[model samples]
Target chain A: MHSFFGKQLPVAVAFFSGVLMIITFFSGDQTVADFSQEQLVWVTIVGGFSLLLGVASITRVSLSDVRKRRKGWPYKAVLLIFLVASSLGAIIEGTERGTLYDWLFQNMNAPMMSTMFSLLAFYIASAAYRAFRARTVEATILLITATIVMLGRVPLGELIYGKLPEITDWIMNYPNLSVQRGIIIGAALGAASMSLRIILGIERTYLGRQ
Target chain B: MNHDIVLFLEMTLAGFLTLCIFSFLYKDNPFYRLAEHIFAGLSAGYYVGLIWHSVIMQQLWVPITQNGQYSLILPGLLGVLMFTRLVDRLSFLSRVSIAFVVGNTAGISIIQQLHGFVLPQLGDTMSRFGQEFWGPLIILIGVVSTLIYFYFSKEHKGALGITAKVGTVFIMVSFGAHFGYTVMGRVSLLIGRVQFLFVDWVHSFNKIIN
Candidate 1:
């Protein structure tokens, strides 16, 4: 009974949701379509609420760490304060233009996030130098294709070889597009299978317990 | 002179922070640790604000009032149910909320899969021997070989193996191309940061001479 209600119930919901959504795409009924759209919004709202659960968990864990004076307790305290302050600011001031919350978002958050993203360049370069090697048939092909694409993408390559643009277009349109498409199809099938397993209670990792 | 001093201070601090991160290449050091901890705190605070403003405010508060209180009631209930994770005795109730969330997500994913993945690929495959035969032929080979390479149940010892080997080449070339492009992108990002530091934060040589 527990398995059926607790675990399988999610699975059943997953299965039915999938089927209904698929049907709604082709369904003629306006009411059915509207209901499906609203249901999706509700699901999104529920997901938003899950964030609160996360915030709550973070608060509990970080406060405990601070109380214990763990190695990074001060940092945790800073994080908690930031989280609470930002959340409260947004709620009270609202997120409209010219608000303090919006200003912080534009100046501090965007630049910092962009900085972190840009840091990836250094990491990727280091990784490539250490890892990229043409040890096998596949690796060799990859190396060659990568070279062509790189050359074709930039104006320098075209200047070096006037025909580079035509060749790059050919590679991207044919082989690249086809292989990417096949992978997409295969992955979709795999996802469907996994969703089915979860709905049926054959998979329960999401439940976060045995 | 006053504005110059303020700019100098901000520029100095930003430069120091950037270098602290770069120091990671040499080895993990105290400077790196300090910078990392500071970034972690700032980013957490920023993200919490983002989630509150972009998601919670837009999806929940506006909808509750602008749309109707009735519209938000069920979602609120479901959101509250997620907090069952906190209560040891009533944790089972959380499953109801999870089921709804999972079910709705699975449903949308299934529909999107067909639209976004299946149809696009089918169009490509069906359009084979298209306007350009050479382009279509290469794509055909790429699709076939990549599929064979991914066929895990079979052994690649015969003619089938050779084809799979060929497929691996194509995939590798594609990856190499992607890697090179990524490197170039990172270099550009670094350049952008340097430009901002130099141009925005400091005067040109002409202004200094004046």
Candidate 2:
């Protein structure tokens, strides 16, 4: 009963819902399509509910740390406070065109996020200078391809060598695509295996117990 | 002068950011710390705003308002359940949310992966040999051999050993390609900033033209 209700229930619903959605994609039946849409909505609802766990967990941990007065607990508290306040504000006051939520979003959020994203430039540069080294045969091929692609992508490539585009495209379309596909397929199979294990109750680590 | 003022401002900010980045080379200092924190705050604010507008508003509010309250009940309930993590004793209630999210996301991702990742990738791989008969054949051999070399189930020796060695060549090329592309991207960004400083703000070219 515990397995059925506690663990299996959600998985069962998801599996069935997934099948239904797939069917709806292929089917012409309006009623069936409608049913699938509703099921998807239910799926979304379930997803949203699940996301709350993250927020709640964060809040719980941060609050606990705040109460205990642990080192660097203040940052956690600030984050928790920000999360809760923003969530609440958005939920209650949010509207389509403009709202206080929109103001908070534009004024407070966009600039900060863009600033953080900008850091990638500096980090990538430093890492490149420090870590980039060709130690083998494979590195040479990569170096050649990278140089060609870089030259080919912009107007500068044409200025440097008119044939760069043709060569770059050939490389990208042929070997690069093949290698990328192989990696992607391997990755998908791994993910599917992992998901299957979870659904079948073979994997229980997420249950938060050994 | 108006343009120069804006140019000066941009150059100043760019210079400051560059310095903050450089400071990391020496040691973690107050300047780097301040810049990092400010960036952190700004980015967090941006993300929070984005979530409010994009996810919360579009997914929740719009549906409830347009479709009517009854239609949104299930999703609303599920979303509320996400907050269950806040309660220490009842925190396990958050699992319901997790189950819903993980199940549906996995389900959706699997289907999307088949269409988006698998089909196109497969098509590309299959078409490669046709485009460059010998080139792709050699690359394919190299890729497969390298993968076999990495495989640990059995020993690679004799003729198989040579194939594995050749495979290493392909792998090195791939990494080199990746590195070169990354460097090119960073260089472009730096160039973009320089262009902005020179053309957009300073109007140095205007003086030359006059």
Candidate 3:
């Protein structure tokens, strides 16, 4: 019974939904197509719940850390406080302008998040310093290309060299476009094949096994 | 009068939070840790409220009540079933939700991947082979060579070896261009933060003092 409910049932569900979606796409009937579109919206609604699952996981982990008095228990405690407070504030206020949720989101969340990403610039420079080795032919090409493109992109590069922008455009439009197309083609093929596998139950990793 | 005071406080808090994040550049200390925790907690909480309003109220509740679309109830129930994972005995029920979402994505993606990415990319690459012959020829060479590089079924020897090596150069150049663009984007974000700090924060501070 457990095996049927836990694993087999889910696999069957996947097969049913997968087949239904494909049929709807190819079906000339308007009703089936409409149902498929509605089902897609259902999928989206279901997906949102998955994010709530993430919140549950975080809360559980943070609660455990605080309960156990872990190394950063004080921070965990602070996290819990903010989590509860922000949630209540937002739920009550509805995220509208002049609401506590909106103010906190704009003032606190936006600033902290943007600053965090901006800090990545400094680290990326350090990373580039370590990674930009030109020992091989490919490495030399990469280093030169990166340097040109980077220099060509900025206003400072235009001040330094008149042709940088034009050269940058050529590289981006030609070789970059070609490689990007190849990558897109490859990825699309891979995705289609993987989807087929999952539909056929050949891939069961999502079911908690290899 | 009170609104002005709140605005001042908001700007001051945002500036202080921005500094807290930047403090990580020097070293990971208490300030950075505090900011990180606060950000994570609030973001998670914000998601809960966002979903409660956007998905539950808007998608499920309003649709059912106002539009009399009772079909949404099934997906809503499926979403609620996702919470069953919290219980040991009924955890298997959550897989039903996962299966539906995954299956839906797989089916849609199979068609999307083929129609949106694969066919369009192939068409674009193939169609560009007129008028500007050399440019398109270079693209073709880059694409074919790059694809050959990824084809690991056959051992690289002689002609294949040379083509694969050429592929590596194209790949490297493309990668370098991508990295440069990414860095530029991060730098732009960095500039935004710096402008906020220098202009907005400083002006606000100056106003407060005056």
By lDDT, the best candidate is 3
lDDT of 3 by residue, A97-153 (tens): 887777778999899999999998998999988877888888888889989999999
User: In model 1, what lDDT does residue B10 have?
Assistant: 49
User: Higher TM-score: candidate 2 or 3?
Assistant: 3
True contacts kept of 2: 0.28
Q: Compared with the true structure, what per-residue lDDT tens digits does model 3 show for residues B180-200?
A: 998999999999999998998
lDDT of each: 0.70, 0.59, 0.88
- Top DockQ: which candidate number? 3
Residue runs of model 1 more than 4 Å from their true location after superposition: A1-5, A199-201, B1-20, B29-31, B50-58, B62-67, B86-90, B203-210
For candidate 1, lDDT tens digit of each residue in B140-169? 777778778888887898989999887876
TM-score of each: 0.85, 0.72, 0.96
Q: List chain A TM-scores, every candidate, in order.
A: 0.85, 0.76, 0.94
Error of 1 at B110 (Å): 2.0
Model 3 spans > 4 angstroms off: B2-5
What lDDT tens digits, residue by residue, belong to model 2 across residues B74-162?
Answer: 66666676665565555454455556555555555666667677676556556777666876675566546655656667677887777
Q: Model 2 in CAPRI terms: which quality?
A: acceptable
